[model samples]
Target chain A: MGETVIALAGNPNVGKSTVFNGLTGMKQHTGNWAGKTVANASGHFKSGKRSYTLVDIPGTYSLTAHSPEEEIARNFICFDKPDGVVVVCDATCLERNMNLVLQTLEITENVVVCINLMDEAKKKGIDINLALISERLGVPVVGTHARKKKSLAALVDAIDGLPHGKEVCRTDYPREIEEAVKIIEKKIPEDCEVSRRWLALRLLDGDLSFKSEIFEREGKALNHLQIRRAVSEAKMYLDKSGIPAENVGKIIASRLVEKAHEICDGAVTGETGYYKTDRRIDKIMTGRITAFPVMLLMLAAIFWLTVKGANYPSQLLSDFLFGLQDDLSGILTKLNAPSWLHDCIVFGVYRVLAWVISVMLPPMAIFFPLFTLLEDSGFLPRIAYNLDRPFSLCNACGKQALTMCMGFGCNAVGVTGCRIIDSPRERLLAVLTNSLVPCNGKFPTLILLISIFFAGSLFSSLTSALILTAVIVMGVLATFFATKLLSETLLKGKSSSFILELPPYRRPQLAKTLVRSVFDRTLFVLGRAAAVAAPAGLVIWLAANITVGGATLLQHCSDFLDPFAKLMGLDGVILTAFILGFPANEIVLPIILMAYGAMGTLPDLGSTAEIGTALAANGWTKATAVCVILFSLMHFPCSTTLITVKKETGSLKYTLVAAILPTLMGIIACVIAAEVMRVTGFC
Target chain B: MNEYISLNQIKKGEAVTAVRVSGSSSTVRRLTDMGLVENSIIECVGRSPTGDPAAYLISGAVIAIRSADAQNIKVRRRENG
Candidate 1:
């Protein structure tokens, strides 16, 4: 037999990707707990002697083309015509998932229903009769706990055992609707890849996407005007039969749901006890009085753990990595290496790499897993559920709340996560505002500034945590304000409504989640930062060392930027460091220290007090520190995030806006702050 | 004659049967696809503290719908209790 192509189809949160991973053994990051998968990923696996290629499409509630994900799934199934489609359903919620299964059956004849998450169902006292369901639906059905390899073998066997050229049992619409579809079916070209009845039903239900899809597939062979005429005739006939024009789709949907109910009545039995536990948890987590406080406390705890926990490890890594620098310098001296080469390699590139890794790795190691834990445990959607009203008030979708949480981890990832929002305008608003939240790279700088400048000797940790939390809260509030402003002016539109499903809260697989996050997110992000930091370090070293007219190039650049930087309550070196730190935010302080010429290498200031002394010697004051913090929180994203924004939006216009928006906000904020402090004599 | 009320009017823990799921075609279809068809048993599970989007238990799924969207789904209190 030839290679069989099987498309994995399902509603969101159905463990479809788990089944794919089980069969293919490829780790494609599954959807967020809310069931939003942005991209289509494919993997190849072998079942017996026949090789099977599996395409993982984005999950959607229906194939009506209300959203982009739904459109992609619909078009791929209609046009690509995979050999057999595997419709995976969550055993606990078979009826809700069966809607997509019936829709897929309409599009293709070959299908096998893989009931996934059987263990979760069994634990919840839910029993699904697989053979009964298969007999009723007239399709092959297999049960599997997708997370375990042993259980998926049966599903693999079912895939290879699918029969071809059999009659497909499709959902039976009402008599009048079936007659309308019959009329429209005769108009569809016979040579089309999709089934004529499916096209007829979609067209009569007022879905025009298939027309364009057919045109794209078959150029000018099908008459568009004839199809439009036939669709109008079908709608008029339905209206004449006492059904309202707009209610055609509703009538069709209800009929399909009735079929689903009939099949579910005989094939499924469950107590639904799991929902009580989920609801009890939701009551407290989303309780109005408790929700805001719980969110705040969670935020504070994560940051506290990150800040306090990362300090010792950061110090250890710094000591270990920098300790090697001395040994390398000793070898260079003994071998009589050139001084410039020694300075460039050791002081420039190597020091920046050490600094970036030591600072970035520790916090990322703590933050990503915590974020993933929330995501996996499904609390992230509840957070979205709580924040939806506020986001709706701002004329944006509520899913922006989840995307904003992603921003707290890394702005680039957050920007990409905007795909969760189905509306274009709101997604753009999210992409533009994501960088307001400080990412892992900016955390160290913000924490250092808060510690040395705001927190004194007594109660240092507490004061630092409180101030950092306040800064984050301010960034979040700023994001809301900017989203509102952008919506009211640049992207004026009504907020699109969504049916946000609060998936049953499940016990997070902590060990697997941590392992996946560490490899997929933390290491991946750290690798990107290191890639840029090395070259950036070389440039910084050259600019500092290269003399031009009795002053190094770094001195000349800083002198040139001094007047403007001073006007904004900063020195030329701070502005120059920020400009250089575009490659990676982790290297900003090292660049500043290098420019100060306090030592030939990045300094190891032991305590906040020592760091304060060094900055005080460099003409820093309280006003400067405050401006620096504000600037750090509001500056352009690092080079990696900018490139990501470019790639995600695919528009230079928005990418430029993403870069300029935050910098302008930072400059305006810093200027206003400086003016206020200067006039009030507060600093 | 039977009294009909929209889903938004139902109190928490009150059971009702859907009489009509109405809205734009897409919204109505989405509601039905979520198993909100006529005669399906539904109960108001809980309301968010702000109380705009309320969770409803329909066909064993807890779906949160805003008040505006919930207004489109009409229901009647269960009888013969």
Candidate 2:
């Protein structure tokens, strides 16, 4: 009677979110699933005076409770009980995608199968008989190119007709399993939401979640111990019949595969030309010897392009903003504004915003578009495939590598990307360790230090860029090592199985990639950094000016942290600025500038010599520079990351570990660097 | 015979059944969540591009499985008749 609840379910990378966006526009909040941080995205749409709430369930392959996403998806479908469910499947990968459809069919009869990416499937010469699939599944099947908004009207019509439709009856498993299912069905309580046949098969497979949920729902009517006994009995019976309970589900799947193969054999006919091309590409991309080098070269090129291409725009933006600031300041002075008010407005707020825009925006605008191009071209998943092994050594799922890759853009997005890692333990491990991968926020610090201290006279910019790349590599290595250490010690467990599909490379739509990247990533970074930087600007202003005794608040804080900073091969000012810049890493350099009376703008490092002179004035030795690099590389994450960690792990203990682990590592690494420098007399 | 047994133990080129996933619902859901259903035939395809653990082809999808996780998975060899 109210808003129609339309549940959107799909296999990963089927462009379900694209459809949600197409329908609901950009008004969506990407947050943790109800209780977990596995990224539940929901939005609303109104079609023909009937408002609809679209819930995007995590893309899962099946309804097996082997991973958290599956469990959440299963619970939402079976319990939360939406008005209708739209199962979006990749038309190109129909057979594989149908596994989820088959599983969903067993659960609820109210389903609309939206075969997405029809255009891509057509490009591949794969012709799907949507009517046949619809008739076979016994549900309304709508073939759609979600990106093009094809057949959207039909999809809506199907959803509207869901309430009055007759129950769709699809084929069942072999008679033996069906017989066993019937027996188990009789045992199950009628009020249980899931189908008895599905429950029976699950029980035989030793699905504890299904059994637990049944017991919880049935209460005293079905004892927990009794349910366990019944499940055990089902397993034993299946085993004695020469079919292991575990193998039962697989047998059914293989049978379905055989049927699907038969259907495709006649329903679709295509040349092997495309398949050959796929093999040829896979040969080089996924090859044993060539893959790693190729991946590194690709990453290096990406970073090089980002840095080289961004330089002009970054300088242009900086010059423009600062030039405006000068004009505004002159206007304020002419208007007889008070000195403090003028300083706070011009030097404080305006300066900080300029730094964020100049330093953060250009790289983001360049990097995000490049990253999105790779993602759309289907190269990103290959990156995951390439990195999965190193990731596995750390007792983490390979998908964490993808999340870590996302971390390069922003850690919040990276943490959210942990949805790809299905295991809660592994996902948590990924989320907690993701901050070790330096985000864009930390890029300016790394870039500034490298440009100022490390790059020599000749090929200075090139050397600085290389140093930044090396720092990123170090951060990634640390993430892997930390994940491995944590998995082995504190969270000792097996990493869950992750099947990452390398989708076929498509031509990335330039316009769409640019628009989405600008809106989604560039603006997101600016908005978040601006929110934190505004108050941070005021705070830094107050700290620099507010004097305790003869020294300012900034001096007092630095002096307080001086002893610890000295031991860690850094000065008090660096540590104090890091602490103050916790809200946003974009302001750390500004805070440092404010401390040194440089008016909190990019210090005029016109030449390498000038940068050297500035460092000399700031009491930074070569050893101090090395320590700053290491500390920045290993330090505790910014406040945003800390809050994300708290939200994802949902335990003060894990959050503490996440924070303390990185902090301790940073201190220890810095101290070690200081000692090495002292002993070697590098200082 | 030893190759089969060792393969049964834990190594690349061995076939294994996903006996049970022993991690949290999040972990299990991720695997099963992605359609790696119980009883799906999983074959170790090759080592990762970095060559630590191995990758496997499961249910028409390629999944990377670490040695540590692989060791926990119990498999019964498909008898050659």
- Top candidate on TM-score is 1
Tell me the docking grade of candidate 2: acceptable
* Model 1: lDDT of residue A308: 76
TM-scores of all predicted structures: 0.94, 0.85
lDDT of 1 by residue, A1-683 (tens): 66789898888787777788889988765554554566677999997658988999878777787655677777777788888899988888888788888888888878999998899899888999998988877888899988788998888888888764556667988899998998888888897667888888877777656556767786565677887788889888988999877788778888888888888886899764337689789889889799888888888887777777777787788779888888988998888989889888888888888888887888789888887787777788788888888888888877788888888878887887787676779889989999999887888888777878888752366677778888999898888888898899888998866567778887767887788788888898889888988998899889988888998888999999999998888899999999999988878887887788543456665344666777888988889999999999898998878998998789999899888888988999989998999999977
Per-residue C-alpha lDDT of model 2 across residues A442-544, encoded as one tens digit per residue: 7766766676677755245667777777778888888988898899898999665655665555666678778887887789888999888877878788787
Q: A39 in model 1: Cα distance from truth in Å?
A: 0.5
lDDT scores in order: 0.82, 0.70
Model 2 chain A: lowest-lDDT 10 consecutive positions:
A28-37
Which runs of model 2 end up more than 4 angstroms from their true locations? A27-38, A151-153, A187-204, A213-265, A271-274, A330-337, A456-460, A493-499, A598-613, A678-683, B1-47, B50-81
Cα-based RMSD of the predictions, in order? 2.5, 4.9
**Which one wins on DockQ?**
1
